[model samples]
Target: MTDASVLEPNAGVTLVPTPNEDDLPRRFSDFATFNEALDYAAQGKRGMNFHDPRGTLKRVYPYSELRDDALDMARRLVAHGIQKGDRVALIAETGPEFAALFCGCVYAGAWPVPLPLPTSFGGKEAYIDQLAVQLASSDPKVLFYPAEIAEMTKAAADRQGCEGITWEDFATGAAPDCALPEAQPDDICYLQYSSGSTRFPHGVAVTHASLLNNLAGHSEGMKIQQSDRCISWLPWYHDMGLVGCFLSLIANQISVDYLKTEDFARRPLAWLDLISRNPGTSCSYSPTFGYDICARRISSQSNVAERFDLSRWRIAGNGADMIRPDVMQGFVNAFAPAGFKASAFLPSYGLAEATLAVTIMPPGEGIRVELVEEERLSGTPRDLSRPARYRAIVNCGKAVKDMAIEIRGESGHVLPDHHIGKVWCKGPSVMVGYFRDPEATEACMQDGWLDTGDMGYLVDGYLFIVGRAKDMIIINGKNHWPQDIEWAVEQLPGFNHGDIAAFSVETETGEESVAVLVHCRVSDPVERQKLHDTIRDKVRSILGHSAIVELVPPRTLPRTSSGKLSRAKAKKQYLSGEIEPIKLAA
Candidate 1:
């Protein structure tokens, strides 16, 4: 695989002609496999472009060149003794090498397991542990990483007792002349590890057919047009990034511009700049925090309309976490001057178990939400004398083609519309099962349906996700979502997204109590106590009860690989004394 660093100069060259006359017609639907989709896309002119931290175009990898390079890498992999059905684990970094290597694995009939790149918050040792754990879970024949992370990768591979080789070294060997093995639709395409929110990450076994079905659904649901292009900074290890942005673009032959995830975190406006600069309609997706960060970054002096032209922005997709209506509205309000429309907000509900998207908000529907009585959300009788509290539930739209969604009660019977219950779905795109973990697989799968472990309701066929069922706080026989408590504390000043985690902790009497962990930066003991009391009071106002508020240092809370706040891990760590709270009283 050619290093993107070598192709940096070609950023100025025009490799493929952008379609100007009309939207390109969909061409790959008839294909049976991902390789077939790539074959069709390679015959076209559209391709993916990579950008540096500063948002400068660094590499232009057209589909045609990508196919040639992938074929070469396929030969090299086979020559190096990577047999069919062998797992080839690759550290997912946004660049040409990973792109080529991933596609090459498909061509070689090998399953590619994408592992997360080391995050800045985790430090080196933590990253090694994470990598080693995932490596052991997948049990890949070999691990591949970029030259930059070779040392860390080697350390992890050695710990897992597996061979590790850099991409450059892996491609250095002689190529075999043998023909590549053909892939069947049911062949395992890759292993996707569910984000760190889970107590234990399970490798999801996704087949080629399942992947293609989801991609086709995404295209159909989005109403893909020739003028549509993608601009994203999402990490490729996660479903939204890998399946939604990277592979979906290839399968659909849509051009894309990528900014590194780290870079986007630093300069989020660069994402908007890419969208503004694109001549075609831009479609981008992000979790609620992404929108919140961008909104907070905007200032009075900044001219949004003059500097950015978001009028062409089409779908501003929201997923990968619980959709916050307030954050979505904040983004629209902040960017409205730049021609960003509220109708462009496309909220969807999905999980990696469903292969990325189970439902997509119908095009042009934007974000339609329903405010239900809080008691209805709790599944208990309402107190009419008390002031009615309302929870804003965003309509996540209908399930995609070939997918069926149901809201099931505790008794395993289907619940009626407007009643909150466990979300279940049956579809062709559903994962076959967890890789080599039938116990985990059987725990979630019942008959042909998957218990999504998420709580939600339906309204005239549209889905409204409430929260993760396991994360629900049960206090005194009533149900409360952790998000409701966390969001309440977030309203306080000096707090930011992901700074709060709410869960239930057991008391000495064996009753569950609401526990809130806050990431605080205040050093003064007086101010820290004030902050803690303020959070407690705010949560009490929302839940009508007191909560145990623990103020920890900043970044103390755990986050998933996809950057979602992990309340489950936070609770475990807090109970285990791993996260020590400040001794304000002392």
Candidate 2:
């Protein structure tokens, strides 16, 4: 490993090393509750910055202001006929408006819900359908959208039989001086919707204290500094964007350069340029596909090598999907000549149920992966010593302070090191429960541990994920799995299964089926057509749905380290035009 000092120049920030893994102090002994921790930051003398490209920068809104704005928003909703605990959906990019609205819900004693920008749908109608489903399930009293989205939001509001309010309209109301309502550490703060990658999303009710505690734990675990800045392109609805990017910055009294999710997709290098131009210790995160896109889309004329200095970037965290080891390396290698440091690649683990972060690899560690036999990792047991092909899977590092992680067997018995099982977590940061789904919630939480539904093992206190338990597709009851389907198609003539992934989806008619999305990896028209049909036929023979194969390019398929396909990431690419779509064999 290189010296932390040596990496500082390339990072463009002063390197402050925390206590080593062996010497670090306890994480949460000082802050008992999330609100207590947030109060500590809110009560601080420092200010916050919500920077935007075209909008005004809110340099410093006192916590008192946040309190007042939240109360005002809450009152406005009530005046519009919303009631306490009524779902209030917010569909805006990350900014003072969204944050204030979320806070307003807290003050109004209503449940605030942050909706992710519509990425799957083409026009306005698909977004309307999505919003309708969320409203039907959540049954929100009111819906709030940014002014730019007002036109489309109206359609959604009309469909849901709910009233819509633009950010401007909400702001016109007088600020409320309503007294701060009493809140329990356990009372719900907001409804965080699921990512909706595989199926219809659910709303997870996160409490004021749960969110705050997770943020506090993230602050300490991530070593977030008060003077730090964050340049983020993550959607506000995603946990990474909401908790990891937004609230973490607020809690640390740091400034954040907030870019719209669309803006980053269109111009990814802008994220790096903004950080370099600002010359602040800034950090941000994205899935493996995001990194691959920037590496592909950002032009060489951008002078990224000379103009951007990544050494100051202390934490280039990767999460929200599987972290790809090669993708991280490729990004570092591509940008290294431009002053980017290798250690900026921070691999992390989290979920919405945990209010975002569960574990974070420390800074300057770069990233590490473990390769164990797939056969040994199968149904029988996790025998690390078995000599199957050892594939490198990225580690999400150790648990934060007060967070305990256990690898448990099917019977809930704790598994030993090198043994894969369900990843269970218990900490102050874990969520209270799933909203309105007591049966589902109970199935996940046992005693204190939250069963993550992910399969992995611990090696030297570091966490390594193998796969998902529920995501497995059981065909013939023999577990017709994702990786196997991808492998089968990748080997077909003219097919690039390395860029091919398979995911199961249920049809509108109600039958469960599978879809295969294959990245073309070729520019020639002849090869592209052959590759598309070849892979599709291969999948059809192996599985049903005759394999809907979308032919994209070499780097199109989303994969994390250990080279496993990320279905959610791949699906997003399919919807975003980064990858081609597929049609089933007629």
* C-alpha TM-score for every candidate: 0.96, 0.78
Ten-residue stretch with the least lDDT total in model 1: 15-24
Q: Against the true structure, candidate 2 has what lDDT? A: 0.67
C-alpha lDDT of all candidate models, in order? 0.87, 0.67
What would the per-residue lDDT of candidate 1 be over residues 1-586, giving only the tens digit for each residue? 4433322346456544343223345664546889998888887778888888878787787788788778877888898889999999999999888888899899999999999988733588878888888888889999999888888889999998889988877666666567999888999988898786243669999988999898988889999887888999999999999999998888888888999998999999999998998898989999999999999999978889898899999999999998888888889888999999999999998999999899999989999989988888787888676799887888998899799999999999999998889999999899999999899899999887999999999999999998888888888899988888888888888888899999999988887899999999999888888887888889888888887888998889988889988787788889999899988866
Across 514-562, the per-residue lDDT of candidate 2 in tens digits comes to: 7676655466667567666777677765554464556554565654222
Which candidate should be chosen as best, given TM-score against the real structure?
A: 1
How far off is model 2, as Cα RMSD? 8.9
| Candidate 1 colliding pairs, count | 2
Predicted structure with the largest lDDT when compared to the true one = 1
